[model samples]
Target: MSRADAYHKMLMSVSHFQHNIALILEAKALEASRSSQWLCHHLSAAQFGQNHGEQVKRSVEIHDHVLDVIDGLTKMEQALAKNMQALLGEPEAPDSGSLGDMLPLGGN
Candidate 1:
């Protein structure tokens, strides 16, 4: 495959990885919110029987880890884009409010 084709494929793979991580983060946040609500309800009703706090804590940890992964991935993607541009001898293009600008990490 040509260098440009290979770069495009790699970019797509990274974009997919980011998308999946975002999905996981969304799910974890939802779980944490529900757990918190459940814990609050139990506490208000004076029925603190189950350990919902642990579940909430775990969910929060997962959410945080996902966020960290996203941050690192973003940095790596930016670096990769820069390196690829240098390798391809391409000049930086103006934004022009393209679709990529609307998507996260300049996804197409």
Candidate 2:
């Protein structure tokens, strides 16, 4: 396969991953929100002497994992940008525009 073709395939794969990860992140956020609400309701009802630490810990762990995923995604995007710049033989200016804008028109 040509270099452009390979790059396009990689871009598509990353796009798919980003979409799937977004859905997963949304679900996780909802789960954490529900857990928080449940804990709040129970606490307000004067329920005491129960260990709520586990739920709080789980929420924190989820948040930390989400942050890690975000960091990885950011790095992936940066690497893709560098690869694109190299493939195009032009250094892309920061904040110039989307990668689509840099791609050649009419299948050059």
Candidate 3:
């Protein structure tokens, strides 16, 4: 494959990765919000210190950790997007072009 072909292929893969990460990040944000709401609702029913709250707090912490992971993934995807954009240049027609057109092996 030529340099352009290799560059395009890498760009396509990185773009796909970035898109997937974005979707995952959205889902994670929703999940974290729900978990936080649940934790707060459950904790508010109780008075002062109580063992029941510990489980809810732990659940919220777990969600927080997952959010942290998602945050890391988001950063990675951003870096990939920047590098891919620099490497591939801007889209000529605001379209990614079909795989059949972009592939080096004649879309095989």
Candidate 4:
């Protein structure tokens, strides 16, 4: 294949990669929000007590774990973007507010 054709294919692949990443991020955010809402509703239904406190603690731990998984996904996305940039002989784009920045957990 010609260089131009190869370059075009690479760009197409990168575009698809970006689109898929966006979808994954959106799905994860929705799941996290649903989980948080469900936890809040249940917690409110139950009367406050030692058991409630323990439940809240466990809920927080689970949320933290989910956030960590999200962070890992974000990192993988960034790495893929950088790899695509390199493959296309393009410079890294300057820092901008990414989807990760919009996360309530601050993408940490």
Candidate 5:
């Protein structure tokens, strides 16, 4: 494909990735809030329950990890989008840059 075509396709891919990451981030935020509320409501019970301490800790940790992952993805998506914008003028480097091997538009 031509350089212009590749650039346009990469832009489209970045836009799609941005939308997907936004939705995922929203979902993660909602889940984190819900889990936080649940923990607040059952803090005492979870801490003192006969056999729920570990479960509570694990559940909270899972939610926290999810939030971390969401944040990482958000940052990655933003960086990729910026690169995409830069490539608008440069038509991106293919078959050379390390990212070209992993990104959708980078595949040959």
Candidate 6:
């Protein structure tokens, strides 16, 4: 390819990354909202059954928020993988980062 063609291709890659990132982010937000709503529904139902105490209510709130954040992060990661595939124009292996290496095996 000519220099101009190469430059155009580079620009296209960047554009694709930006567009896909936006789509994924929106998806993440939607997924998080759905999770929060579902949690709210179940918690409301549980509250109707009996008085579980303040502890239960507080725990439910904390769990709901944590789950929502985690689901959104998962969506973000999956979206990034899809974006990588698109940019490569082919199917590629997933990238897995393992933290085991960072931990000490044993204290001698």
Q: Is candidate 2 or candidate 3 better by TM-score?
A: 3
Give the least accurate 10-residue stretch of model 1, judged by summed lDDT. 99-108
Q: List per-prediction Cα lDDT, in the order shown.
A: 0.69, 0.71, 0.69, 0.75, 0.73, 0.69
Show the colliding residue pairs in model 2. Answer: none
Candidate 6 ranges with C-alpha deviation above 4 Å: 44-108
Listed in order, each prediction's TM-score against the native is: 0.45, 0.46, 0.51, 0.65, 0.53, 0.42
lDDT by residue for model 5 (1-108), tens: 998798789878878977997787798779879978987887775465677767778778877987888688867965885696578655654464345445554354
Backbone clash total, candidate 2 = 0
lDDT by residue for model 2 over 33-62, one digit each (tens)?
Answer: 998898777754234335677657766886
TM-score winner: 4
Clashes of 5: 0
Count of clashes, each model: 0, 0, 0, 0, 0, 0
Error of 2 at 76 (Å): 8.1
- As a whole number from 0 to 100, the lDDT of residue 6 in candidate 6 is 78
Alpha-carbon RMSD to native, per candidate: 7.6, 8.1, 11.1, 5.9, 8.9, 8.9
Estimate, for each residue in 4-105, the C-alpha lDDT of model 1 and write its tens digit: 798789778767876886787798679879977986677542343367786677668867976897798678767766766676677565553442344555
Q: Can you tell me which runs of candidate 4 are displaced by over 4 Å?
A: 45-56, 91-108
Q: Model 4: how far is 32 from its true place, Å? A: 2.0
Model 1, residue pairs in steric clash: none
Error of 5 at 32 (Å): 0.7
